[model samples]
Structure formats: structure tokens, C-alpha cells
Target: MIGVIKALYRTQLLSIKGIWYLFCSIRLVGMNLMALLYVRQKLCPRQIAISENGISINYCTLYTQSEHLAAQLAIHCDIKPQQKIAIMAGNHNILVHALFALARLGADIYLLNTELSATQLRDINNNVHFDWIIHDPEITWLPPINNLPTYHENQISVYALLTALPLTHQMKIEITHFAKITVLTSGTTGRFKLARRSGQAQNFVSPFFQLLVKLNLSHYRKIYIATPIYHGFGMATLCMSVLLGATMFLTRRFEAPKACQLIAHNKIEVVTLVPLMLDRMLTYSETRLQSLRCIISGGAPITATLVKQVLDRLGRVLFNLYGTSEAGICMIASPDDLAVYPTTIGKPLKGLCTKLVAKESAANMRNELYIKCAWSTGGHYWVATGDLADKDADGYYYLNGRVDDMIVSGGENVYPFELQQCLSMHPKVKDTAVIGVDDEEFGQRLVAFIVLASDAEQTEAIIFSWLKTMVARYQMPKKVIFVDELPMTEIGKVDRKKLRQLLS
Candidate 1:
């Protein structure tokens, strides 16, 4: 707790001037009754809030535009409180402004992924029953729906609409409650499920403070968010940027060279990305990332090889975050923790209760990880993570695999993640994914899909010879297939379903 206070002080949020601006920013969102009593002041009028595509937007302009957009939405689009609205777009200034405007209207906002297919979108819309859709010009291929109002970047310019509206001292509007936002799951396995975060500020106190102290985010003045804003990891970064008044860097689409250029030119201090994005950036020169103080990797399973590689190339700046969409962020592995055990996911965050539940009454068996935290979806009750894990003597936790992903081969239990981790340690293997396939003698056999290093040449026999010493006989893969690259999900997880399709 003392460390949290120190971090906040370092960010200047504890000072008198900072307090005033913080209060004003909250008031601008219309989240409190005290806002009505306090004197009106612009929220960080001169401070730059967001930078995207070589353009910068200050706080005053952001807030004012949000106000104007809110009024226009209410009058022209018939947007009202409790109305369900969907925003399907990438990270941009308009996206930020639209979020603020919708919050001011006290609407229920659903964040849709840009990678979602049209059929998936239709399925989601049927369940959510959205009142309106605000999307970018790139997403112009929306399915036709009767009587549905949609706003597109190419069809309607938000700034132009706001400018066309009449200017008044104040709009006749009062926000009685804060907006409710629904974030979708990664949908890696199947259909996406809706996950709602607690809107109360008190609910965020535990994890929020823990991140500030552990990541030292308060000390960073510039941050580059390389993940999608619709995801929990990226959304948290967006909110933190506002709270600390740090300059945020965003891009509609992620490109390795472009991202490297931006980070190098801007001298970005903090970077939030997935492991795949980090790997792609590493393909460029390491000097481009020398300006970074902290690099946060989440939204996917990070291998031990990647951890060691990051430490060797980037010093002690890498942090691995292990979490789920429903559970939110629960564990953080710092550089020191990774140095000790590259495979460990470190310890649980403060105010979280974590336990392992076994599938059977057998001893020395890996168990499913369950967590109970204030910020998670369920209240007070333990949320099943569906991940099989075990803890070391020193209390560091390591994931074995998913409970459903465990395969029974020759009446023996085998976890694919274990084999995949071992394969990833090989010098010739760049990346790999292991899956269970049907077998005649054994109930199921493991098949390894590997992507070799660009400069290395290896055969299945050589890989098998190397793996003989590393893994047990039952754990060995029955077949090894080399590929140029493995299919990946939007959030950077290996697409096992697609890998299984290749077997067919």
C-alpha cells in the first residue's frame, strides 16, 4: 500500500494541481454528484492526451468534442440512457471520443472486435440486440439489417456533424449514472462470450494499485498500446493513460516496422503488447526498443524460450502477465521472477485468493487453477480458470495445460503444453503447437506442428532424436510436421482447431 502511494505521488496525482485536474477529468465524465457542486474547469486543457497517425489531441479538445458528440447523438440519433450501442472499430481518436460520448449518455456499450467475421457479428447482434452501430470506414462490409441505424467513418464525419450543430453555453442533459460496458471474450475455441466488468471505482482499487506498483506505470510519460482496445489488457492501458495523464500512442492496425519506427521516434517508455507482436518487433533492430522502460506481454501464453530471449536482448524490462478474459489479470511475472524460473507465472496479485482443485483424489496430480478476486466476473465466489497448473516450493505457479486439452494416450494422461514447451527449447524450432490425434493402438497420440528457424534445416528424425532425452516415451509426439508458420488467433494464441483441421 505504501508503494502504491509512492507510485501515485511520482505520477503527480497526489499533488494539489494534479488533484484538481483529476477531479475535473472525473467530472467531465459525469460520474459523480460532487461534479454539480464544484466549479466548472476544463479537464487538463493543455495536456496532450492521445497521439495517433502523427496527430495529437489535447484534453480540452477531447472533452469538448465528447460533449458536442453526446448532444448530437441525443438529438439526431435518438440515443438515450440504457440504450445498447456497439462500437466496432480500431484504436483511433474518434473511437476514444465516441466511448466518452456514449458514457456521457449513460448507455450500455458493447466493444466488438475488428477481426470478427460477418457471421459472428450477426450472431452477436442477435443476442445483444444493439440499438446502433458506430464503426470505421474499413468495416463497411456490414450485413444489412432492417431499421438499424449505423454510423460509418466514410458515410458520416463525426467532427463535421458536431460542427454543424448549434453552439450553446450548455446542453440540457444530466447524467444520473455511469455507463455499463460489455467486453467480449477472445473466442479462441468457439463462440465469444460476454464479460462485464464492475463499473464501481472501488472494485478496481486492488488490481489497479497492484499494477501501478508492480509495472511502475506511474513513472512512464509515454506509452504505446499495440493490442486491440476491445481487449481487457488494452482497455486497461487506455484507462490508465487518462488517470495518469500520460500521452497514449495508438494505431488502427499493427505493423512491425511501423510500430518500431513510432516507438523509436517517440521514445516510448512503456509498451503493452502480445507475445507475437513482441516477437515480430524483435525481428527489427534492438536499438528501436532501447527507449522502452517496461514491456508488458499478455492475452496469450508466453513460452519460456521467449522469456529468456527477451531478457537476453532487452535487459530486465519484460513482464509476463497470465490471465483470462473472464478472470481479468491475476498474476504478473517480473524480470527477477523469470530469471529464477523462466516458465513460472510468478505470484497472485494482492487481494486475490488462488487455489488448485484436483480432478481426482490421486496424489502428485496437476490441478485446475481457480481464482477469487474483486475485479473478476463472479462476486466473491471462486472462478474456475480451466487451466491445469502447479506451484513450486517457492510459491511460483506454472501452467501445465488446459483441463480439456489433456489427452489420454495408452491409458496415460498427457498434457500437450508440456511437450510443446520442451519442443520450443530446441535450437532449430522457432515455434510449435502440439495436439492430440486419433490412433489405432493408443486411444490418442500427440502430433507436433513445428515452425523451424529461418536459417536452420531439420528433419523429423533429428527432432525425434533430440526430444528422446528431454521428454518421456508416452509424452513423445507420434508425428512431426514442419510448416512455414502456425495459425494464430487475434490475441496471439495458437489456433489448435485450425491445426486439427490440417490433420483432416
Candidate 2:
């Protein structure tokens, strides 16, 4: 009876602490909003803000560079407040500077994917009609546009722009409203569309609080962001690191071995990456990961097998976050949660609520997840995520797969994620992707493409025999094809579209 009372008391204390943090977060939002107006003058001179390739950029230098670039955008590029500008650049210091500069001008900045082909970029621009296109000279794929004015880093130098224009203590252009930042969804299944987010005060504070409280981001002195800056996962970490005055280490692209080396060299406390990156890092030496206090994983589905492997090799520091560009981070699975419910995506964030709505075709209790939060899009109370999920008796949610990815085989529904998870546990299988193919008798049949581990002598017959013990007869793949490597999308997800093309 005493133990039960103690446990109840602890739970109540935690709830009270959560409420206190929420109140503090809301108050900080208002303070940060006011600080946005005079952001340039609020720089800390001695603190290192960003570190890239052994070069450290202090907050004072970051402010001066951003100011100079803001002047160039107004005077040379003829850019005005509220004008639309598209930025297509890699993860570089210059790109970070441009982001702050554009924010200062209150320009609607569209962050284009650096991996997009020239044709796709043109197609997107044709529909959006951007006022200015600022691109990196290293991006050679972009075709010259005759009508729009394009500027490169060389042509628009902050130093040159500052020298040509008179020094002014006050901002030359007054921005009445904060800028709206436009981020694009990964168009794996369909064409990408813009997800516009107004530069509201709460927009910044919510993520900051979420990271600080959930991921213990504030305690980490150095952070390595391995994902692309154009995506939400990478961009959020960058912003949070800057706000906390933490040293940020960035790379133009993610290389597993190099990333591990950077973490070891810089004594990085926190490292944020997707599952694919983590899988590759696991192959390298585990000693390189000793300095890390936390490893944040998101932006893709992670299998139970991979989660277990991370815990075994790197200690219990993995955190899996589930979210989308349309809906901000909905759930977070901590290390303790994953130890019990390995596949669970954990509970909802403090201010968010989630419900499972039954899919029209699903015979089981499984349903599509609908999230309601302040950051949800579509101007509705609840945003249908289109991803199917189910909650356990303890209220931990587990993702089955996307609704569209569900396959009906012989009148039995089979989720590819389930099959993929089962196959991934096989020692011989390094990576796996499952897709449904047309079948005259069953309506649709599952096909799996697998990448075998190095020096593993497993054949198709052996894998099939092993899988029989792992999954149900109907859940097993109708056909298994071995591959050298799985095709990946620009954002590091399995390219199912290209995989289907390979089948054809």
C-alpha cells in the first residue's frame, strides 16, 4: 500500500512539472517574438554559433553577415518585403545566413530540395512563380531561366554589398509582419506541394520546448545534424541549436563513417539522423559513439530489429519521433518506452491529442491516426494523417504502415511494414522493402526486395524457409528478389516507385 501511494505521488508530481513547463514555454514564445525585431543587435559576440569543416562562426559574425546579406537582397536584388523568394542550396553557412536575412525582410521563402532535378525545379517554379531564385553555384543541374533573375553567392557577397551600401544602425526595410516559411513534402508517392507555416511566435517555442523537454536538447553543448537542412527534421535541430547558443556541426551530405568521426572528434553530445543513417553507422566502430548522450531518430519508419541493435551497441540513448511536414511532431518514443514496447511510437506530446478512426476496409480494430494540435494544417480541428496505427492497452501507439501501402492478398490485409520488420530480423537480410503486385487470384500479392549482408551465404530458398517460422503463411512474401542495394529517395526513404519500375 505504501509503494502504491509513492508511485501515485511521483506520477502527480510529474504531471505538475509538465504543466509548469507548458506555461513557461508559452511565456517564452511572446518574449522571443519581440526579440525577432532586433535580432541582429541581440547577438552574443564570444559564443560560437556554427562550426563547419574546422571553421567556427561566432554569433556576432553570423549577425553581421546576415545583415549584410539583407542589405544586398534589398539594394542589389531589388527584393521587397512580402515578395516570394526560392532558395535552392545545400547545407552551408551561407544558406543559414540567407535564411536569417530573408526572415528579417519578411520574405516568403520557399526552401527547395537540393536533390531535385532541373526539370522538377522548373516544374515547381512554373506553378509557384517566384520573384527571385537564389541558388548555389555548385548546383549545376539548374537550367538557366531567361525571365527570372538568378543570383549566385559570388555575385551577391555580403562583404561587397556592405561596402557598396552605407552603414545603418537601424534596419532599412521595416517588416510589419513575420515571414511565412514554405517547406515541401517528400513527393515519393505523388507530386510535392508546399506546406506553408506562418512565422508565428508559438511556431518557434513549441518545437524548442518539445526538444528541450523530450530530447534533453538544452543539456547538449554540441550537436551534429546529419539530415538535410531543407527538410523539417534537420531545419528544426538547426534552429533549436542556435536558440540555445549550442555549437552546431553541419555537413553538405550525410556520410556514415564521416559522421561517426565528426561526433567523436567534436565530442558531440547529441546527434540527429534517420534510421538509414543509423543503420550505416552501426557497421562502423562502436567506440566512436561514446561521446553521444542522445541519438534522435525520425523522418522515417524504424523497425524493431534496428531499434534493438542500436540499444545493444550504443547503449539506451535512442529516441524515435513520429511527425510529418503537415503535422508537427506528434509522438516521441523514449529509450525506456522502447525497451518495453519496441515498435511503439510512444504517447502524444503535451498539447496534442490523437484518435484512431477505423479504415473503411480494415476488418480489425486498427484505424487511421488523426492528430489535433495547434500546428496541424488544413484549418481543421483534427488532421487525418492517412497513416494507419493502433494503440496498446497501456496507450502506446504503434504504426502499422501508410493506408495506401496496405495490400489485400486473398481477402486478407497485409501491411508492408509488418513484413519488412519481420524480414529485417533475419541475420542474412541487411535491408528489405516489400510492395504489392497484381495477382489474378488474390487481387494483390506481396513482393519483397532484400539486400543481403556481406559474406552471408543465404539464398532465396533458405530465406523463404526461415521466413515461414517468422510470419504467418499469408503474410509471407509471394516472391523474394535479392538486390545489391535498395534504391533510396532523396530524403533517404526506400524508393518504392523505382522498385515497382524495376519489377516491370
Candidate 3:
């Protein structure tokens, strides 16, 4: 098996020649580390940047890069020491360098998501000027960007950092008045949570990519980030990659077949994926995914079947981590955990705390999972989360569902999330969600709403068999209703309440 794996890997590597021409444009990016790298080591403020070639970030290099960025600011945007700017692009190496330069120059940074519609952008722009809007040139439909003043950067958002870079010691500003950063929460729950960190706030937690590089997990020179950078998961991956000194391979658009080629050719490591994306990759390839050291899974829950399929088909490098924008990484399921309990989301990360709170009441032990951490962000721009959960005697927290989606069925509790996760595993079920319907016999009945793959109808018997084996009798959906798509919020989380209302 090992020999076969090696032979197959060789075949995949050779196929990269077909795609090498695509990465030729990477030369357009230049490094300009001047004086910005210098910082108090006690603060540990200097975040590291790594490349597939090797990490070239040193004190002198970082310093030079900072100085060069400061020079760019004077040459480009006339920035005042006290002024703040917002960066509206996904993760780019230039963006990270820009953040470092911004900190050195005392300019505020606001991280904005690219998915916001024009009306939504208008509301956000009202809060602040986003003085500079640097984005993947591919995001062409930005009506909000057209509303902002012109910036000097091209394609990448590096210019945002350059505009804020020039004010080193030239213009003095108070420490309290340095750049502030806002990370919009990935609304896993019903509502959005906005987290605001002060210009000098140390609340931002560094991601784990640096630790992975220091440990030499793999020889991946390029970090493949196909997800949206504005999301917390994508931002964390990008931040960690730059700090680890990896060249970020970004896709203006994500396509599964093309993503496969990048992974094999660039020696990409640490590819962050959402469950749906993973499903696409599994559908695209039948053989082992080549050259990937750690395919980190997060963003949403993956069913046990999907987990098993990825592990068996791809190599043993699947690292599953429990996530929330609010609490950081709560738990990590390593390769060993996948071998034992393929479905488990793993144990909590060092600083986070995990608990499962009952959905109905305190005595109701069978509830979804809830977690608390010192790092648990208080609120997203002061918006709180309404996720329901439960905790066990051993501290293993299992998710019940969203508190808002709770269905009281014949005095029994129903969590739409758990049912949805289970139903999504069916081969015929491209996507599935459970919603409560007003029933006369059982206060509420579980109803499954599905959008099948290829529009090919699947057998209810097979789905019933799978559900009977995976869930309890009462936990199962009473009726399976096929749909074109499940209701979703602006941030991409399933809207159970909306689905329930639709069914009603």
C-alpha cells in the first residue's frame, strides 16, 4: 500500500506540468520589508511570514519591509498618523504585510467580508470610510468599492498597507490611538457576531500554521487558500500561512477540478476546506489527494460518512477542528481520532472550554453543545449568539441544535442541526435540513427538506435505513420533503426557522 501510494503520488506530480503556467504570474508580487518588522519582542507583536520556498522573514528583512512600506505611504496615499483605513479583500500576502505596516504606522484596520451585497455594503460604509478598498481584482461587481475614494494598489490590496505605512516616527500618535481591527463573525448561529479589537488590542489570537511549519509537518512551499478570506476561517488560515512564510496560492474563483491540480503541482499544504467543498473534491477525484500534508477541516460540521470517505480515499492527513469565530479553535481531531471515532469533532484546543447545554431546560441533559473560552469573543460588534448546547460528565459536548430552531415534538426535544447533519450524509441527498411542522399528534413532527445531487430522485427506503442506523427513532425526520435548496442566511448558515415557516 505504501509503495502504491508513492507510485500514485509520482503520477500526480508529473501532471502538474499541465498547470505550472498558471502560477507564472506570482512574480508580480514583491517583498518590501523595511523598518516595520522591528517591535518589542515582549509584545510578540511581530507575526511571521512563510513561503513554500522557505521563510525569508527575519528581523532585518521585516525591518526593511516595514521601512519600504512606510516609504510607499508617502509616495501613494497621504496618510495621517491618527487616520484609520479598512482592508476589504480576502487574505493576500500583501494584506498581511500591510497589517504589519499599519501597526507600525498607527493606522486602524477594519477587515470586511466580500460577500456583502450593495445594500449591506452601504450600511457598513456608513459606519466607516474604508478609506481604501483593496480586493482580488476578480471581485468586479463591488458597488461598495465604486462608492469609495480611489486607491493606488493594483489587483492585490497591498496598497492599503502602503498607504498606512509611511507614518513611522515621522508623525507621532498615542499608543491608544493605533489601528483597530474588526473581524465579522461567520454567523454559525442565528445572528451575526461582530468582534472589535482595539488598535493595540492583543485579543487577536495567532493561528496554528506557524506551529505546523516550526514542527516541519510537510515541505509545502505554497499554502492553498481556496476559501473566502473575509471569513474567520479563511482569514485565520491566510494569517497563519504568511506568518509561517508560505506563498499564498489564491483563486479568484474556486473550482474543484482546478483546486486538485494546484494541490498536486504546488506542493500545497494546509488546505482549509468547508464540508460542502470537501464533498465536491471527493466527487471530483477517485484516487488519493496528492502532496497534501494537512487538509484542515472546519467552517461547518462533516458527517461521519464524509469523514470516513475522505480518510479512506485521501491519505491519513485529515485534521478536523471544531470551530466558531467567537471562541477560536475549540477542539482538534487528529489522524488518530479519525481512526477511532471518525465522526468526532475532537477535544478542545488548549485555551478553549467546551460544554453541552440542554436545549429545553437545565434538567434536560440531551442538548446540543455550547462552549465558553477566555478567548470567547464577548460579542460581534456587540451582537450575541443564541446557539444551544449540552455538556456531559466527561466534558464531551455534543451539539443539539440552534436554540431558535428547537421543535417541541410530543414533549420531546428536536434539534434541526443534528438531524440536518445526519441527513446530509445520504448519497442521494446533496443537501438536507430538518424543520418542525405543527402536528396534531406530536406537538411537532420532524420533516426533512432535501436538495438532491443531479436532480435524480433517491429512494426514501435507503435514506430511512441510514437514518434508522445513525439516529434514534424520535430523532428521525417524520417526512422527507425534497426541495430545490434549503433556506440560508446572508452568512451561509442554514435558516431553520425560515424552513419551518415555509413548511408550515
lDDT of prediction 2: 0.73
TM-score of each: 0.89, 0.84, 0.67
Writing each residue's lDDT as its tens digit, candidate 2 over 1-504 gives 344334323323224543454345334322222233233124335567788999988877776767677767776677777888887766778778777777766678888887677778777778777887776665666545422222344554533554455555654656435567788886444467777776676655554466566676646669888877788777777776765557879887777788889989888988888887888787776789888889988887787878898888888999999887776677899999998888788899877888899886445556899987777665348888778888989999988788888888998887888888888888888889999998998888899999888898777789889988988888888788888877766566677888888887
Clashes of each: 0, 0, 39
User: Which pairs in model 1 have colliding backbones?
Assistant: none
Decoy 3 TM-score against native? 0.67
For model 1, residues 1-504, the per-residue Cα lDDT tens digits are: 799889878766676766785567465555621221111224345677789988998766776777788888787778888888888777788778777777777788888887777788888888878888777766765656422223334445554555565656667766535566788885444468888765666777688788899988988879998887878787778887777668889997777789999999999999999887887788666779899889998776787778888899889999988877666789999999988888778899988899999875485377999999877888698988888889989999988888888888998888888899899989888888899898999999999999998889999999999999999899999999998888765555577878988888
Whole-model lDDT, model 1: 0.78
- Overlapping backbone residue pairs in candidate 3 total 39
Candidate 3: tens digits of C-alpha lDDT, residues 217-238:
3255456776666666776665
Candidate 2 at 15: error in angstroms?
A: 25
**lDDT for 27 (candidate 3):** 23
Best-to-worst order by TM-score is 1, 2, 3
The candidate that wins on lDDT is 1
